[model samples]
Target: MPNARSVVVFDAFGTLFDVHSAVARNAASIGPASVHLSEIWRAKQLEYTWTLSLMGRYEPFWRLTERALDQALARSPEVDPVVRDTLLTSYRALDAYPEVPGTLARLKARGARTAILSNGDEAMLADAVASAGIGGAFDAVLSVDRVRVFKTDPRTYALVEQEFGCGREDVLFVSSNRWDVAGAVAFGFEAAWVNRAGVPDEYADLAAAMVVGTLDAIR
Candidate 1:
């Protein structure tokens, strides 16, 4: 639970936005492999981030996204190269989850300061927020690009305190990705795991402060 002064920081991809919707939007062109492509693309994107961070190397998340898509396309050769451009373009404006706008509004109406702390690059976050028409909802959109790394890294999580001058306990970090919520918990933030899929929890030692089915359930 967040206190009145707690800044509600959301993870962008799976929490606020429906990342799989990019492939769903172009399903007609992707054919039966659409689901596999989305799964592989997302998995590889995160893998690349961790791999790069371990190697003390960095690539902008946008580049990792493209590289991951290429890998997914290669694995699903049934998907035509022609739809590649369409899929990539759709990622820039991926659909927001139905409750996002109203939830953000309610939080703001209650005087909570909201923000997004994402692995997405600045430009990617800007485009997605603009496309969702929720560009003004956040007080800050902190990207890992600022630190040249990705989440699970303490430096990435540190951006919250850096931005708001708040202690870890003064933040409620929300993410649909359990690993992200675990990372926030490890960093000492009051974390909420938005378990939209009703999946069993992992990272038992670093459990979230709360778990909810959706953003609307926060508070």
Candidate 2:
């Protein structure tokens, strides 16, 4: 959004990484019901974060993700501990979107410092980055675990400033999540909504400076 060079801070889950693949990775165990399980698990996982944020009773994303899986699995005909464990282990590495690798490379070629601000635990993020083969592409990976809270919170945004030594205007925050984009905009960062699904921005008034269909439009 900023014409001048700026730091790029990305949201990890739905933005940089493909969360749906988290369950899909366990397809061998989940079988034909994988899509339903993924949808339930992902939805509840986010809902739990918001619930925790509102209640001020924060749990690590890993625990919350597992809880979401449990809730989704409870509706199934039978439960397999091995299957659940396999799904939980799958979280350690999920696939990145198709365009992500090249997008980051281009952002770096033009001299922008990049970092990932995620709800994921450190090990979760580490494994994801490593699995994606893009660990070297990031300047840093920040986690809400430090503050023990979830995102769309001002404190989560502040972690970027605290770690990167930059001001809101000098940073371009990007996320596929409208709430996250709104939170960064509310915190004064120039933001771009990577509207991957082509969904309308509910907070159009608060608004990202640019709303692109993919990260390819970022530069």
Candidate 3:
């Protein structure tokens, strides 16, 4: 892993925020199987992100997520419009995982420079950070909108190094997604896979600096 003095950059959605919780909160109105619906909604949302990236047809994350949700809902028309609105409203205030505040505090206390590199828009991310009550925890919050590209793209990862005013080697990047871990490594940042789901076997060749179960485990 990079040295402790190096800046640490994080992926916003899965790394810091409990995006699943937001979905779970709204899933009930969308269908009878609320949890399952939320799972499918998340899967489709990510699928659309990667698909759009590969197709070189980029859209904002909010619009893309809404489109993916609509498609997922079509498979289950029994889903209630009220539930959909509930979930959509919930997006405006996603909860951070329980470990987040303490972990961020630890990093900040150590004088580590921290930033969020997310697929979300600046406005959306700003609100998320503010509502989470951790807006002051980060040195900066970067969005893909600035580069018009998503994670796994070299340009997206470059933002981390740029914002920290450091070389890629001077940053410690953390991500829960395997592809994102690989991309950050490829971009020359020392990367860590916060494999909270225990799915690291697929990324054996990616040479991450560390593999921890959660943000709290990071040193």
Best by TM-score: 1
lDDT of 1 at 2: 45
The lDDT values for all models are 0.92, 0.86, 0.81
Which residue pairs in candidate 1 have backbone atoms (N, alpha carbon, C) closer than 3 angstroms, thus clashing?
Answer: none
Name model 3 segments beyond 4 Å from true: 27-32
Scanning candidate 3 in windows of ten residues, the lowest lDDT window is 23-32
Over 4 Å off in model 2, which ranges?
1-5, 78-82
Clashes of 2: 0
For 148-169, candidate 2 gives per-residue lDDT tens digits of 8898888999999999898877
Worst lDDT 10-window in candidate 1: 1-10
lDDT of 1 by residue, 62-142 (tens): 999999999999998888978878888999999999999999999899888899999999999999999999989999999
Residue 213 lDDT, candidate 1, scale 0-100: 96
Tell me model 2's lDDT, rounded to 2 decimals: 0.86
Query: How close is every model to the real structure, measured as TM-score?
Result: 0.97, 0.92, 0.92
Better of 1 and 2 by TM-score: 1
Cα deviation at 208, candidate 1, in Å, is 1.0
